[model samples]
Target: MRVIAVWSIKGGVGKTTAAVNLAALAAREGARALLWDLDPQGGASFLLRVSPRRKASPRRLARRSVELRRMVRATDVPNLDLLPSDLTYRTLELELNARKSPSRRLAVKLTPLDGHYDWVVLDCAPSVTLVSEAVLHAADDLLVPVIPSALSLRTLEQTRRFIAQTRSKAVRVLPFLSMVDRRRRLHREGCERFAGGAEGFLRTIVPMSSIVERAAEARLPLFAVAPSSRATRAFASLWQEVREQSASPTD
Candidate 1:
């Protein structure tokens, strides 16, 4: 399975939104997709209308006492499953650090799910913690949602440097602009600067829209709520780019 992590060290960059929409789009295209909500806040789980069960203990999950598959729950979307996140996941870093090869723990846990899923979309928490490190090691592609701003661009560069420091040749970093408002001069300038598809940045720019916010309130992906919306089309284009890139041989 191709593991795509929707992550950023900085929060509120539309990471969870991208994760849910991309996963939904993958499932819509008949791919068996699992959305693993790794954020302790459970944004993706809540957005998907899946509640976290009390049975999921952070230590047990980290130690493999409880199998990953057992925590998998089906969502309303066909072919889309969810591994719900719990508040206890806040302590998952400690548990993972207590284990050997902590950076590879998540990848090892996902091994058994290889044949069952075509795509595993990870909704990651915003931080550079042990959990984030594990995600960096586990994921085949890092889908970073960057707002069109100087700080967001800096964060994206930091993420690229982090990946380079890991020397992980297998994982690719795909950064895309999110919450872009063309009315704002900075937003328009940022889009024009990075939208050229240079330095591996995605060409798709997700615009700020009330329809996207409505999808969260409606507890559904934008594709299910308003497929024809500009935001939804942007996400669809982003998914298409991701699919094409994932299929190509690693450089």
Candidate 2:
């Protein structure tokens, strides 16, 4: 199974939205997809229309008799499931830090659920703290959403450095522009510059649209609600790229 983590050190960059849409697309493509809501904010859970429930901390999970495999809940969409998040996840870092192998705890906890899912998409919190580190350790690939601007690119640099510093075994780090608007001069210039220089990156860019916010308001995936929309086509192209990457042999 491929585990893709939708993450960004910078918030409000559409990470949760991408995770929700991508997982839904994956499910529609015949994969058993699990959207694991690692963000304490539970925005992914909210988008999936799965009510958040308080889950035990890593310590409590480690001590519990029931395996995490039992906690999975089906979404309204077929072949897509959600592992709900709660406010208690806010303290996950502290609990993880207390462990011997904190970075790998989440990976270990998720092993049993692996068999049940073809793809596990983690909606990570917008920080590089312990919790984010733990989630990164569990992820097979990291998908970063960046706004087409200098600040977002700077954070992208930090993310690249962090991944290098840790030498994470995560096989892939894919970064793409989110909420891209071609109408703006800066956005257009950014795309042109990046297109000329951004080697080894997927070319599909998510354009800015009210459809995304509408999907959020409707608590449904964009493709499910508006299959003919530009946003839907963008996600479909993105999903195609993701599938190609996941199918490639890893180092």
Candidate 3:
């Protein structure tokens, strides 16, 4: 399965929103998709209206004592399953650090699901830790949502440097503008300056919209609530680009 992680070093850049929509879109297109909620806050899980059957203990997960497949729960959306997260995941770093080859643990855990899923979308928490490093090792693609601001752009560069430091040559980083309000001069300028396919930035721009918030509040994907909304359309375009890139031969 192609693992796609929607992550960023900073929070509130629409990571969970993008993860939910992207996985939903993948399932809508007939791909067997799994959305793993790696955030302790359970934003993706809450958005999907899924609760874990038991507390996701970091110790069990790190030791491989728990079968990931057994944790999988089918969502209301067809062909889309969810691996819910709980507060216990906050201790994941400690558990992983106690193990050998912690960075590879996540990838090893995912190996069993390769035959069952076409795409696995990870909704990651915002931080740089052992867990994030594990994600870097496991993901084939890192989808970063960058807000239209100088600081956000700088954070994107930092993320690049972090990946370089990890020497993760196989993982492709795809950054895209998110929550952009075109009416603001800074937002427009930032979009114009960096949205032009520079530094592997994506062409799709997800505008700031109340409909996105509404969809979250309604606990449904944007497409399911407002398929014709601008934000929904933007996510659709983003998914199309992601799909094409995944199908292309990697360098």
Candidate 4:
């Protein structure tokens, strides 16, 4: 599986939303996609209409593949499934510490289903916990969605430094602007600045449209509900870029 971790050091920046939409888009293209809800709050579970209560401990999840598989449930969407989360995951770090390499714990859990999914999207919490660190170490790519604001930049910087320090499996950091409102001078300026920053980074910014809020309200992917909206188009474009870049050689 091509694991993609959607993360941000700051909360409320649409990281989970991006993870859901991107996974759905992959599923729409006939790719088998699994959304792994890593956030303790379980927003991804709520979005897909799945309950996030887990009865198993992290040690149990690490030891039994069948048990872990039993926890995974197919969503209402075809070719899209979910690995639900519970607050029990808060102690995941302590449990993983018993292993030889704690940072690769999630990666090991994913090995059994190597060919089951074309894409594995992780919806990480907005914190630098052991779980989040493990996800960064395991993922093939780290998609960081930043709101177009000055305050969000600090979080973005922290995310970059952490990724670099880990020397993560992530070959590239795909940073994108989200919740953008062109009407706001700050938003426009932030988008322009980010777009001009790098080639590996994308220029397609997810506009702050009510369509996004509506999608969340309906608990559906943005494309499924509002395919014609600007946000939908932006998401589609971002998916395309991901596909194209994934095909390229990594240094």
Candidate 5:
């Protein structure tokens, strides 16, 4: 299976939203997709209407006491399943740091499910922690959501450096502009400044919209509720970019 991690060092960059929508679209396209909500906030789990319960301790997952297979749960969406998250996940870094080869632990656990899933999307927490380090090693593609701001660009730079330092050069980092305000001059300038050349940024931009925010209240992905909306169409385009990357991904 190809693993995609929807991640960003800064919070509120539409990270989980990207993960949920991408997974939903993957399932709609008949791919067997599994979304793991690794954030303690359980954003992806909540959107898919799955209860945030643990079948096993995440701390013991790397040690083999907690098997990744047992934690798998079905989502209401066809061809999509979920691995829920809980409050305990806030302390996930501690457990991962305690393990040997923690960076490889998540990838190792997912190896057995290679034949079972077409895609495994990790809805990661917003941080540069041990948990994210594990995902950095595990994921084939790291889909980063960057808001139109100088601070966001800083984090993206940090992410690039971290990946380089880890020598996980096989991981393809695809950064994109998200929650962009078209009326803002700064937003337009920021996108133009950082979204091309060697940065490997995507051209599709998701505008800041109320439809996206409503997904949280509707407890569904934007595609499921407003397929014809501009935001949904943006997600579809985003999915296309990722699908192409998955076929022949590279650093």
Candidate 6:
């Protein structure tokens, strides 16, 4: 599986939304895509109509592939499935750290699903904990959502540093500007500045839209709920860039 983690150090930057919609679009391409909700809040799981699961302790859960398989919940969308988050995942740092090769435990547990899925997307929690280290090791690419703001860039730099410090895998960091508001000079200028200098910054910019917020309420990806919306088109372009870059070498 081509593992991708949709992550950021800061919350409310549209990470979960990007994860859900990207996975949805991947499914629409006729690929088997599994969305693993690693966030304790279970926002991505909820968006996909998957219920929260009881905590699957990493120790036992890692050894038993059968039990691990049981945790996957199929979504209404075909070619798309989910591994819902658990409430106890809040203590993932403790659970994951106890294991051997701690940071790679998530990758080890997910190995059995390699042949079953064409893609595996992780919707991560917003924190720089042991869990974040595991995420860095598990994914082949880090798909980050960056809002167009001064603080947002700082958070991005922090995340980049963390990945550099702990990665066991050659995970590419793909950052994109999200929740962009063209009406505001701050948003426009920030996007322009990042695009001008950043090598991996995606060309597609997802604008702040009510339709995007409503995707959570409607329990669907932006593409499925409002295909005609400009935000949806932006996501489509983003996914295209993602697919092309996913097959290319990591920077």
Tell me which residue pairs clash in candidate 6: none
The TM-score of predicted model 2 comes to 0.94
Query: What's the CA RMSD for each of the models?
Result: 1.1, 1.8, 1.1, 1.9, 1.7, 1.8
Report the candidate with higher lDDT, 4 versus 5: 5
User: Per-residue lDDT of 142-238 in model 5, one digit per residue for the tens?
Assistant: 9999998889998999999989888763899899999999799989887677665236788778889999988879988888788899999999999
**lDDT tens digits by residue: candidate 2, 1-251:** 78999888999998999999999999998899998888889899888888644453445654324477656788998999898787767877887777778787878888887678899999999999877777778888889988889899899899888888766675588888789999998889778876722845567888999999888899999987788999989899888888888888766
Q: What would the per-residue lDDT of candidate 4 be over residues 1-251, giving only the tens digit for each residue?
A: 78888988899999988999999999999999999998768899889998754555556765534455666889998999898776776766787777778888788888777788899999999898878778987788888888878788878889889888887674477788888888999988887777844544576788888998899999999988998988999899888877776677666
* lDDT score of residue 144 within candidate 6: 91
**How many clashes show up in model 1?**
0
Better of 2 and 6 by lDDT: 6
Total clashing pairs in model 2: 0
Deviation (Å) of 59 in candidate 6: 5.8
lDDT of each: 0.91, 0.83, 0.91, 0.83, 0.86, 0.85
Please estimate how well model 1 matches the true structure, expressed as its whole-model Cα lDDT.
0.91
Candidate 6 runs further than 4 Å off:
53-67
For each of the candidates, give the backbone clash count: 0, 0, 0, 0, 0, 0
Tell me how far the alpha carbon of residue 114 in candidate 1 is from the true structure, in angstroms, after superposition. Answer: 0.4
Quote model 4's TM-score. 0.93
Clashing pairs in 5: none
Off by over 4 Å in 3: none
Residue pairs with backbone overlap in model 2: none
lDDT of 3 by residue, 39-102 (tens): 8999999999998776456677777767888878999999999998878789889998998989
Error of 2 at 180 (Å): 0.5
lDDT of 1 by residue, 106-188 (tens): 98899899999999999999898888888988899999998889899999989888887776547888999899999999999
Candidate 5 global TM-score:
0.94
